[model samples]
Target: MSLASHLDELSRKHSDIERQINAAMLHPSIDALEIANLKRRKLALKDEIEKLKSQPTSH
Candidate 1:
């Protein structure tokens, strides 16, 4: 996939995870570990997106 599309997909996933985290927070029954995992995944995606964005595009 092209970098732009890949970034878009990652961003979409990050947003979804954010929503999941917020929804999970609303429920007291949600496991803390699960939330932590979700947060970690979100951070990973964000880091990847940033790393990709920082690279110089090749012609």
Candidate 2:
């Protein structure tokens, strides 16, 4: 896949993760440990998306 496509996929995945985190935060029954884990994963995705954005484009 091309760099642009790869970046786009990453962005979409990041958005999905963010949505999951939001849901977890709003769910009263969510376990503390599970919420923490989800938050960590979301932050990691955000960092990766930032890295992808920072890279120079091939085109």
Cα error, residue 45 of model 2, in Å, equals 1.5
Clashing pairs in 2: none
lDDT of 2 at 26: 92
TM-score of 1: 0.98
How does each model score on lDDT?
0.99, 0.80
- Quick one: best TM-score, which candidate? 1
Report clash pairs, candidate 1.
none
Residue 17 in model 1: lDDT: 100
Best by lDDT: 1
Model 2 C-alpha lDDT per residue in residues 1-59, reported as the tens digit of each score: 87778878877887887788788889899888987887788788778878878988766
Residue 28 C-alpha lDDT in model 2: 91
Weakest 10 consecutive residues of candidate 1 by summed lDDT: 1-10
